[model samples]
Target: MISHSRRHCVVELQALPARIGQIRRIVSAQLRHWQLDPLIDRAALGVTELLSNVHRHAQPDKTCTVEIEFRLGRLTVSVIDSDPRLPVLREAAMDALETCGRGLALVEALSEAWGARHQTGGPGKVVWFSLTAAPAPVAAPRPVRISSKPVREPARTALVAVDPGAVSAGMSVAASVGARPG
Candidate 1:
């Protein structure tokens, strides 16, 4: 069976500085729950970059959403912004030391996988990334042994009969366990 853990937070703030604390709290908890802190740092950085980009680009009163989903072995964190403009991959020189061009580039380097796509239900698009964490090992189920001696074949594979009355009833073979009172 697949078990998924998930969380979502909405941010509708104007200033970038105001939302950092909230983002940190939510993202840190998710990272810990997923057991991916080492990789989570990169994810956090990516989230920060994405959130900052939203704040810089999206209009005021625009709402942004952050979501984290944890599967058995992988974790994904997505930031959905109101802006329909998807993030563009830019080719910048590594040593250029550019002030503004390094945000998304840095995100790309840190995350295992990161990209943007249009949101399915709404007009705006979602910019998101996925990170895989070490999966918890599943213990194998123990096998059961059945006796080799053949007994009376059961009428049904697995069945339990109950008469809806005040009666003592039992099934027996060579020994009389209890007689059903009808």
Candidate 2:
């Protein structure tokens, strides 16, 4: 289940292996609804990692709250658990077979900024990451150029030329059409 405001969403659930997948889908759908399709993959991945951490390392119980917010051109995803202990970002593992300790590292690479801290109004800690969502700068429209000078064309008269400036300036310039010599 989820509760949401105009720019924020919250989900409270047990961070079990099964529930994690559901939370990911919820995040993706929310982003799509907000017209942030580009951010769906990154947000979903970051949320998954945070929830997995809650399931694996958080103590006491696996219950947690996930919050997703879009504010001031940034999309932030956070997971709050009862565990007071903050997570430490470990160095990247050297072996390809290693899979247990790379969650935080992956989050760091995917997000513009990320951190974990003790909750301001509670005992637990919230692990959060932010991705930049600023819209691309729009190119200004090119100014339309209206030429002040008029275009001149050769008159159909056998030996006459028309001055475009005189005609455009309300001056009359007449030329008699002559028969062509075949």
Candidate 3:
């Protein structure tokens, strides 16, 4: 399920493998609707990582709230779960063949800033990351040049066969006839 207001979207769901994919699609669509197409991939990936964390590690329940909000030239994605434990940014080396333990690291590399905190007056924690959003391009006004002098129309010119091309002898004699509107 999803609900939203201006510049914000919230989805409540069980963080199962199947539900995570659906949430990614929802997040992508929301970004596209807001004309933030460029942020779709990053935002979707960040949300996926957060949701996966909830599915893998959260205790007591798999239910979580996914929130995506845009404000002040930044896009923020958060996953709030009932577990109050904040996530740690693991810097320890992992096996080359390891497929897990790198989700948060990827989020950190992709986002401009990211962190987690315990929810105020709640039993859950919100893990969130923020990406810098570029402002939508606005059409710039074209510059106009004004001159005090009156605009001059182009002169019309025609070639006249002066002396009938010098009697067809090719004497290279021609005259230009110019005309101006009355």
Candidate 4:
């Protein structure tokens, strides 16, 4: 069951060069508002790559949905597009310096887990990645009292010595004279 505290944000737009940056900023802002600051950079990067893929490859339309969900101590960033093709993760070659094929590679390296799924009963697919957030610190359990006992008061009183000369300047002259010894 999904908890009521779960957070979710979604943006639907054409995955174009201009919209990618706007979506990245939106994703960053949502993560920040959710107090998932550590995930912002990675989430933004992953979303950028996913949207770029949509821009370059999605069929019929470049329109897509970007979704962010925080649940079960994990933050998931996903992009759903009209393209039916699942993404292929190309192995990073030792000497290749191509800029075009590194999107999924970077997503795999940065995310805890990543995958693509064909949308059920639909003509599109959803590509997603998850990052595990550090669990919130559990509050220490408070001590509970099972029974009560009679309280014992101190048997003696402590007397504190006071110096008359050390009294505040607000003291009346007559009161100071009366408090002093000849």
- Which segments of model 1 are wrong by more than 4 Å? 1-15, 93-95, 136-182
Tens digits of lDDT, candidate 4, 1-182: 11223498878899999989998898888888888898889999999999999999999999898888999889998899988999898776223777687889889989999999998788999999999999667799999978978899879865544445546657665565546454
Instruction: Say which prediction, candidate 1 or candidate 2, comes out ahead on TM-score.
Output: 2
Angstrom error of the Cα, residue 95, model 3: value is 5.5
lDDT of every predicted structure (CA atoms): 0.66, 0.89, 0.87, 0.85
Stretches of candidate 4 exceeding 4 Å from the true structure: 1-6, 93-96, 136-182
Return model 3's CA RMSD, one decimal.
8.5
Better model by lDDT, 1 or 2?
Answer: 2
Scored by lDDT, model 3 comes in at 0.87
Q: Which of 1 and 3 is ahead in TM-score? A: 3
Q: Looking at model 2, which ten-residue stretch has the lowest summed lDDT?
A: 173-182
- lDDT ranking, high to low: 2, 3, 4, 1
Q: Count the backbone clashes (under 3 Å) in each candidate.
A: 0, 0, 0, 0
> Each model's TM-score?
0.62, 0.73, 0.73, 0.70
Candidate 1: tens digits of C-alpha lDDT, residues 86-173: 8787786245866775777887787678888988887677887777776556789888887697687768754434443423334342
Taking every candidate in turn, the Cα RMSD to the unseen true structure, in Å, is 16.7, 11.1, 8.5, 9.9
Query: CA shift at 109, candidate 1, in angstroms?
Result: 0.6
Superposed on all Cα atoms, model 4 deviates from the true structure by an RMSD in Å of: 9.9
Error of 3 at 176 (Å): 50
